[model samples]
Target: MTCSEWADENFYLSAESAYIEGRWETAPFQVAILNSMGNDEIRVVNLIKSARVGYSQMLKAATGYQLQHKKRNGMILQPTDSAASSFMKAHVETAIRDVPVLKELAPWFGKKHRDNTLEAKKFSNQRQLWCLGGTAAKNYREKSLDFIIYDELAAFPEDVEKEGAPTFLGDKRLEGSAFPKSIRGSTPKIKGHCQIERAAQESETDFLMFVPCPHCGEYQSLKWGGKDAPFGIKWAENNPRDVWYLCEHNGCVIRQHELTPHFAKAQWRCHKTGITTVDGYEFLLNGQVSETPESVTWNIWTAYSPFTTWERIARDFLNTRDDQGKLKTFVNTTLGETWDDETGEKLEWENLYARRETYLPTIPEWAVYIAGSVDTQDDRLEIKIKAYGPGEESWLIGYKRLIGDPAGELIWQKLTEYVDQSFQHASGAKMSVGLICIDSGGHYTDEVYAWCRQDPMRRIPIKGASVYGKPVANFPRKRNRKGVYLTEVGTDNAKDIIYSRLAMQAKDLTKPIKGYMHLPMVEWADELYFKGLTAERKKLSFVKGRRVYRWECPSGVRNEPTDLEVYNLAAVRIAQQHFGLDLDRARPEGRKNQSTKKRKSVHQSSWL
Candidate 1:
């Protein structure tokens, strides 16, 4: 019998512990996952689930079944040592004490059992069950196992003791067993980072929890509101408890009270059409897709949970709609899906390079204004020069890297010379940088200030503000200890605009009317520039029930190119607003001496 079947036959819920016991039949979705343990072909079972959905209970029941029936050694890994110990104490011990069948067959059920402890338990027939933390050290190298269970996989650190992913190491323990099984489960946390979601996407059979409609009896998965969703939870203007789920098939209203009856008829549907079974569990399919039998992955949301109510979920959604933190929790624990803090496309170096133009680092013909940005580093300084045309259209005029210590004058001199130099425009007119914004949030703060004060051009010291959802430029927040005024740049706002512009699918190097990033020739475009441009991604993180947008870069990825471009864009903005640079107006032809003529006449009138 499968683990769920075994639980139905023997496992009993303690009144002090469970609201419902021996109710495996209620969660038909979990039956296949639990039963797959006995299938030698299905080596791994992954459950990417929502919170309070009996996932933990299922794991505990599976462990108990393995100890009694298979009599095989198994290991269960939690997120941390403390969590592992708590699971052993609260759930494992209680199961041995309360379950009548476990007490009758397991040798360690009694109080005087010598082989049982908090971490490890010895069962009849020399069987053993070990409860270990995800980071419980490499001590398991010597221990062989028949089965492995990884719980709360998203919470496990990317690295354990600098060795590697904890789950990867846990699988090694089952190397000695011929028919080893690995069960992975977790409530997903972050997009692109959730282990359970990753495993599910790679699984051979991706299963979604489905329930039959009371009216038409057509099976469909419960959907949180989306473009394709026809039926969803509808509530009155002011009453959350007045919630009802709409059936897409029949357009019938399934009241909150109707969930239990419908849940009894729930089943797991295969995404692809085929007739298959994993050790007697039925999988219905419709397409002519071939099956690769190796792993079975399941996804379950709280919408189908018996312990939860539609009204309560609606109320929670209404309450958390305005707050990021609560909304993230609602998505992860309620919807059983990862939340995108900021929905945007990831930067790819190849894609950006594919749009490269033939123009060199020199200013383009459409140039109306030019700006410079510098990013300071310990060993070098990164510089980016941009030229703006009509409608805020811009091109990467030049890029330079000056190697030296920021504390020394070697790199600073190079930066000064670069900014002072003039680039010949397509009109044969010389155009120097109209504005230069050097980052002042580095060790060279005082140096940057002193240099800006001495510069004869439009150079200014600037710092990035930590505030989110603000304008790209704001009034100075506070001055440095040296009494130097610094322009505060809203990096989050700037990045949002930059990403939006980068997302534009341009056919050529010509800039778009509204917002577009123009790239230069192949000489100026390289792999490193593209890497920095697409290095960081916008991620949504929750704090105190509020959503906080974070610009995160993976470890070992350099984001200096992105930083330099942001500051450069900020400089162009300052020039447009404060310096009266008309980015939308084209520079007039044969107007090189217009300003000079006015100045000469004014000088003659003053002499009179």
Candidate 2:
């Protein structure tokens, strides 16, 4: 029997571990991913996934298939001892206790209860399923198994007590078996450092779930569309509330509800122009798959989750384009792509100054949300307010430096009033600053922290880390001595995204492009504005024989404009993540929270 078929017939989900508790039924999109684990030809299967995508349950089903159906000895290992214990309780224990087939074949009971331990489960069929702790090399030593399941491989330590990579140690255990197999899955972390990504790259085949377009019945992978992407997924410039997908083969508007049960009409495709073979396949680069290779590895990314929408993804992209860290999460978790930091762009004050538009204080017609950032000094506090629109196209609407002792309450109060005031969008809509990020790394840290503590949702305290790959926005819950959350800003990471976007200065002022920044010809952004914003240039230097990139300004030049831009970008990210700040639909005034509830519509994708 097929693994998915076995699961459907006998598997039952315990209420404790699963959100949907019932008879185990494989989702349509999950059929290929689950079956690949049971496929005898494919000896190595790896899944790079996002959360809420049934990977945990998929692993459980695969384990049951190995023990009950095939009667094979296997092992499942987590990253840490605690995590292994937790998985045993939440997943393994429940499956055995609830499912009748699993219960009858289970080996939890024996004299002195030696077989039913967390470390290992001995089945009645003379086959044993070992549960190993993630850290120690000793756990992998005694296990000579037919197959191994590496759960959350990214979380496992790179080296187990300096023995070697945990995966290598596990692979050494499989040499004894004739048809040795391994399965590893994770959501991935940073690029060049992700375990799951590296494993998947080694794989011979990379399969993307493709669904047929409702209109033309042509199979195509769903793409997040913009200028470069003309089809697949599309959204409005001002409202993601009205989002839909464009059929790649035909220009058919498939509403969000029309995509219900994406699995029922979906199939896995690995090549741009040909069929997929597990043991040997090609990767599509620049729209064409490369030569077919030979190996025993299969890679799968559950790109479309049952609950995920093109609108949510589109809005997230628009909301996070200005923030590198948040955009990295979007890329990793949503797009299932590794993020590479590329932040080298030359900036000239003359070019930036000349491109200024003839606008006063009024917000641009395209702007839908607003954010403010502050740079604190001993003598003054510098603030810049930027308005954002669809695809993160932004305008520098205001910049002001309040001259006063930052330690005094007078300046802080002024700052609060300034941020609290509303601005008029060209559409006559009003907008309150969605979020304000204040630099608390300076001498006035106490005052900044205290003020931010009063209203953390809007007034956020920030500290620049300049870490290479850290996200621009994170609530590490690192509280100050005064009991205030001090947010860590990845200034270097944010600069990478900022400069890349700034480099894409659109020549045509009317065209709205993602990451394009617009400046006004106002007194606030006068002669020094461009100079301050362009002060810092990317400088490459060798650190311990390794090339490292750092943003450097001339010794005496002021770069508060660019610094404030990072803070504001982080502010927008914080707002998006913590405060539901959707750039396409999120509004601070007169606009209510857009209902994410899937609207009722005819299921047009199905053909009788």
Candidate 3:
């Protein structure tokens, strides 16, 4: 019998653990995942899922099915011992008590059987079902198993004291069996760090479900799209009441009820498994789309369980869209996707590239003053020049890389020439670098200080202070031992300012708003530059029992663009403190000369 058929006949849901308690029938979408547990060809099954999808019940059913039908020894590993104990009471033991077959297989009744205990259930056929917590290393000692179910795999401790990941240790337990099978499932959390996601990507096949459109009778992968997409879930004016799904194949208006029965006809196909496409469209899945729900096709079929509806998912998105942490939860729990902390919180590189204006080598018409930021590196110095208009409106005027060692003077001379070069404004006026901040947080700190010491007012050395709530620019009372005035930059506060502004330009915004960043359409402002700027994600974690927000740039990801932007922001603050510079009260374009002729001043005043 199929796993689903066995489950329908044997598994009984308990009142405490299930919303609707009765005979357990696996949903169509869940059938493949449960069946993979018994499929010998598939040694490992990973179900990266959303909540309220009956995953917990599948774990219980898989246990009961394997115990009776297959009679295999297994382990149900949970996050903690308490969770295992609770699962045995609320799920496993209840099944033994409510179902006659399960009771006959593993008796937990009035008989005082020592083998049938809290964590272990030894059957008459010399097979055992062990439930243990994955958090403790000792739990994995010397137990041989046929199958292992990793429940909430993401929540399991990453490592037990230093032995290794719980997954690695758990797999060792099933090494004794020839037909070893493992199942791992969880609702993913935190992009790039989701354990189930890693497992799914590494597994033999990653399956995606595709449902047929009832009206067209044409099978197409479901999509959650905006009003403009080919077809998917679309709502009017963000109203959940008006939410509906448009069929991908026929553009038919499909209500939540129309797709119910058709879900049973859904099929799981994965490109990685060599099932390439359906009807010329790439094999796609909804949850794999970008952090933005509308990036690609939406899998309304993903919400095909009897418990959830398209309107419900839409309502949840609407409720949690404004808050980052809550939105992360909604994506992880409701959408069955990983949440990128910067999804709605920061600007996408492609969108930033799309908004590029043709203004380059020349400052914009409204630009007032300029600031330069240099990010020192091992082999190069990343430079970014920005112009600010009224209200701190910023434009990325120039980007260049000095490809050499900062320890040498040749690259410094090149940078000096570039800094000394003049940029033209639209009104026949000249603009020069007003202030420059050289990052002293690299290999050549003394070189940075020496360069900045050339002109104290215009060039200054700055170091980043990651302390929370620190002011963006806090000038020290005195210079360091090197006799160079070093500025402490509050990187977190600066990121807050920059991120809040970039949030307005996430994807599409036609008009210029306050503090909107404008990029130039030039060779330097390519995809690499934009990716660097958007590389870091602001992640929230607790350290010492207090909430700490830290910017995380994955290993090998270039973050110089971000660092340069932060340095320029710090330069602005320092300029305001040391020089008579004003971003809000921008000087009018025309000079106060009675000649009535616009004359350009090649020499910028009070700038480094």
Candidate 4:
């Protein structure tokens, strides 16, 4: 008997299951994908599906069938250890306890029970099913498996701690098996990086679930329609309940109540030709056998789900279409597709260097406020000084490197001297550092705190926070070990802003009201500084089925310059909001004498 057939006879869905019954006919398309396991010629199956669409549950069903009927050793890899543990408790435990056959076969399935543990289950049939996290590839080395299932393939780390890619390591386990098989599934993430999407593209027979139109008898797939479409949901003015699916073939408007019956009779069809496969109409008719060694892939969405109605989807679309966070969720979860971020593009260092201005040991006339940031490294402290003007137009006036251990007192003194001094502008006015932000997340945490505590109003210690949608600078969090309140700088937001400004062309700088970054000609000429500034590129990532934007750098790339710039920009924001300091306005009378001394030092310094 096939895996889906066995699931139908003996499998029972627990309360945690989205589809409360293990009936193969209701989702015949999924059954066909699972049934492909019985084909000795086919070695791999890829299911790229929407959330709550029975992807993981299908794997569990296949596991139960293999344990009882096929009796092959297998493994399941989740994104992380915590996620693997949760999946074991939530799905694996429930399946073993609820399914009568699995209970009788895998009797010792519990904590501290010898035969079955959280990581592995030993069935009476002498077959083992191991569940592991994908982060540690070392664990995947010694195991030989007949079957393997990778859950959320796109969420796995690109490389596994010097061991190499997860997929390559998993494939190594199949080397011993005579007819090895693997199934990879994910909701997908970014286009280029999505593992499941890549696998599906490589598969010989790619399938899409299609249901016949109740009125016209034409088979069609669900699509997010634009102006031209054969199948898409349309709604009346401000009314979600009035949502209806427009059939492209016959123009028949199918209501929400009519969708469930059609879903029950859905079939798998070829994505390219729109022709139904041999198993497409098996439920409505008799099965037809075919012969091929090609691997198979299937794509399904929430439109076929009995749990999520069309009206609810329409309402969700209406509320979240305008907000990026909510819109990303809707596109990823409901639409079952990846969200492509416009800001996740790489910026060329050459393009930015071309916009540099003539070098001077001073700020320009457009400069209003002076802010500096320090990046703590084990070998040195990298400092970046930026001058800000109206609309946050900024110039990189200075970049300094103090070569010494950050943990030592010598580096701290050098950083202080650079921060305390001022630079002269072409207008002959001196500008001392209005605000300074130093990294507090390195080995020199205590040193950073000491500097910030010396003058809390101007010098602030900051730690980068990667939470999505965080403001440029969040409210100060708990005091550090040194009892100093540290600011949480939103490095993600700063990168988005910086990248947008970097994308600006040299000709576009003359445009008014645009954020312009002016680079120093000589300072940016250094190869190390240029590499550090453009070290990281923006990329899209999926976290818990939501699209997240993050900055990613290739290994061995030095991104201290990028981090320092983020800190400097975040410092200006904090100064404006928390300290009521305005860079666009003239300096206060109380600080005028300090600037005179600072200007004099600039002229006398040897480096100047």
Candidate 2 residues 516-578, lDDT tens each?
888888777877978898888765432321235678788999999989999989988876677
Q: Which ten residues in a row have the lowest lDDT in candidate 1?
A: 599-608
- Model 4 lowest lDDT segment of ten: 599-608
Look at candidate 1 and tell me the lDDT of residue 379: 85
lDDT to native, each model? 0.73, 0.73, 0.74, 0.74
Q: Tell me how far candidate 4 lies from the true structure as C-alpha RMSD in angstroms.
A: 15.0
Judged by TM-score, which candidate is best?
1
Candidate 3 residue-wise lDDT, 1-608, digit = tens? 76777887778888888898788777767676666655554567777778778888888887777788888889999999999998887887787787777778765465678987889888876778888888999998888888898898888877776899887888898888877778788888776677877776666455567778888888766655645567777777747788778887677988878888897777666655334222212333553421211111112224667887777877776776556577668768876777665434456788878878887666666667899999899999888999876667789988899899888999998988988788887666678888888899888998898888887767878888856778888877777888777998988888888877765643433333568887788998999998998888777543321235677788999988888998898887787776767765634433233121322332235434
What tens digits encode model 1's per-residue C-alpha lDDT throughout 431-501? Answer: 77777888988887777887777752366688888666766765354555655546888898888888878
Measured over all alpha carbons after superposition, the RMSD of each candidate to the real structure, in angstroms, is: 11.5, 20.5, 16.7, 15.0
> What are the TM-scores, per candidate, against the unseen true structure?
0.64, 0.54, 0.58, 0.57
Query: Per model, how many backbone clashes are there?
Result: 8, 0, 4, 1
Cα deviation of 600 in candidate 2 (Å)? 80
Q: Kindly indicate the candidate among 1 and 4 with the higher lDDT.
A: 4
